[model samples]
Target: MEENLRNNLIDKLQNNTISSEEREELFKLYNSYQFSKEWNENTMGNFEDVRKKILKGVKLKRNGASRGKIYAINSFLRIAAACLLVFFTGWLGYTLILKPDPNVIVESGKSRKEVVLPDGSKITMNINSTLTYPRVFEAKRREVKFEGEGFFEIQADRSHPFIVATPHVKVRVLGTAFNLKAYKEDPAIETSLIHGKVEVLTAKEERTLSILTPNHKFVVDKIALITSHLPQTKSQIEVVPMEFIDPSNTAPVDLAWKEGKFAFASSPFQDIAREMKRRYAVDIIFENKEAADFKYTASFEQEDVVDILDALQLVKPFKYRKEGNKIVVY
Candidate 1:
């Protein structure tokens, strides 16, 4: 009677009309084969190899037995392949569902992008900059991550502190306007507070470097601290306090981007080139090291890259040429 039942199931599987009850029975048989001592003793290999081994083993066991047993073994092989296909399909579906999507992302390529956060805070991202935040602000505090440069105008919310996190440092503020510059390739991280108050801290140790006030810029020389032989402590890190250029001016130098202008005061030529690169999305190469070492105090309003470079030349005797997307200075 068992032989007749097995033969009927095998016929149904071969004809592609196997019933649900027959599939359950086949699963039980497959499980038994999987946990058997013979299966465990066999060295594990690829799925194909394992399937072949199982088929070979079943055939050998029923050799010279009866035709019904041989048919049952073939039926098991078909079911095993179907089970493997289903397993992979289910796994692929699970992975797709679990993948995460960026809740809020702002990217500025050759131009700037203005983003308003959920808490009514506004951020103006500079060229080649990126800012990411969650879809909703957390109950306790509002947090966001940033790369490159951004000017933030945060709404007043003393109850919930707003935090901006970067690779090198973190800035915490209740309600204030500030500018943060933290590029991965840059050697320093700069935070300039325009109004209200903010606290800057190192990312690694969460050590508060300084509490900044309006019109003050805080600079952390990361390379100098890392290479220095001094004791590696929060106290040893070099934090420079520099005053914004022309406080009497309507907009401080740090906030010049908001007015479509670039301002600098006694800034190194190399540093100017870096700022030009960020603003124009073009490369500024210095062919002469001496030219790069010069310092200039200047500002440009709504000027193109060539115009800015020409203005710099008026202050200092230097030559520049444009080659495609790069400006070569000598």
Candidate 2:
């Protein structure tokens, strides 16, 4: 083979791409290369290591695998990572299931919705999230109740702190973008900050005062008066001081729902049903107990309940039927 052929082969091999014949040709060429043995020792390794490294590094974009075989290495690692990406149907699912706001966001279902509020935090409820709030608020004390969830970029008026109160806890924020999860049956209340500061208060006690900067988060236990705060700063710029919630590291994932999508994080079936009912304008009732425990972690956009049920069946097999306006999950 010519030098150019060798170079091209090297490129493909490095990128984990080769046809059956190409693989055989590459094996012969790679061995013939100068110091090729050393190169192999240094570059190539078991597939698992490669896959973990790749998956951990770049989150491939959705829109099907047009990623070519570029920058890939032929190893079990590539196979595993590619399998995961393919299994999920793509990498980055911009189109997500507009899940119920964990805090209190009323979602419009297959119909138009208008959400009036106490402090004039007017939110236009989209299909699928049942949101409830007080008609008003008082000073040194601000509370609005909600179920499901919503993506909020609060209108800042620092004097009256905006608190999205649920039965379990409250997510308080002033002038910032974030997503909250306070479903009725969830074991914990999760608040993720996309920008700005927020505090989660329980038992009306603000001790240690879980203060969260951007990208940082504070999750409160539903029953227990405890709080959990994860590290938010970057690992590389440790010396440099900056605050932002790393969407790449938080769970219940990012909030692309308001933009019309559903984003779940291994959430319970019941919670998922509640979100669907609000968004699709259809009711999701559990017909079977076994299905309720089924957990899911995926995203979609304006998907019907059948698709949702199909996804649920992936984790926990069950039966179901439709009852007029409701989905009976058995």
Candidate 3:
């Protein structure tokens, strides 16, 4: 009776006419067999061996059959072949299709790019940033790897939490909008939460460093953490409060790039030069080291490289000259 029921369930499944209850029963049976030690040990071998064994059994049966019995025997062989084909196909599908290569990489170079993930989450990637994500999310979570800078607006899926991984840190959120800056060349990794909540973890140890709420910013010095071993002292990671108090009410300083605006609050000249190169596709060379160390507070909306440089000159005395694709600063 049990064998008959199992065969019937498989038939229903193959024919695509299985009821929900019957499907559940079939799944239970599949799970039981899938977890068995014998199944694991046997299923690892090549499928061709199983096919050869089935053919051998059919050949032995054909030789033993009489002329009158041959017609019945042939019919039985046909059914047996069909059943074997279905069983092997199902087994292969279960073993192979369950764990596919999930990594799908998206990168932006020389220009900013926007990406929409499988789960409706959106990422506005800065120039030279790369994002690696699964083609399809796993059962319990949605995760992605990110390099450089990106502003993320994640969809609300509390059951399947979203995670973004960088070289230095991992940010996990159920649903949130945030900006992440984690350039390999940069000394620090920064996460500024616009809304909702996010938990930050260290990449090497998977230790929960901080949990951020709306209007909070988290910064970690990569060099400090790597060079020092002061567990009793203050951690290299720091959390600070940020306000959205721009006169135009556009966005926070960290997230202003998403609006095609370059806004900086006392940012170093070298850092500004790096951002300028990414935004304008031009190389900036500081002739003087003192010029690179200068910090400036400024904002520009769709300004040309020459115009921005001119504006900077008015605030702080600096000489700049453009030659071909390169700008020399002193």
Question: Which candidate has the top score in lDDT?
Answer: 3
C-alpha lDDT of all candidate models, in order: 0.76, 0.59, 0.80
Q: Enumerate residue pairs that collide in model 3.
A: none
For each candidate in turn, give its C-alpha RMSD to the true structure in angstroms: 15.8, 32.0, 21.3
After best superposition, candidate 1 residue 207: deviation in angstroms? 1.4
Query: Residue 65 lDDT in model 2?
Result: 35
Clashes of each: 0, 42, 0
**Any runs in candidate 1 off by more than 4 Å, and if so which?**
1-102, 225-247
- Per-prediction TM-score, please? 0.65, 0.45, 0.65
Model 2 TM-score relative to the real fold: 0.45
Q: 93-115 in candidate 2: lDDT tens per residue?
A: 43244433334445555653556
Pick by TM-score: 1 or 2, better one: 1
Model 2 lDDT, full chain set: 0.59
- Candidate 1 positional error at 78, Å: 17
Give the worst 10-residue stretch by lDDT in candidate 1: 36-45
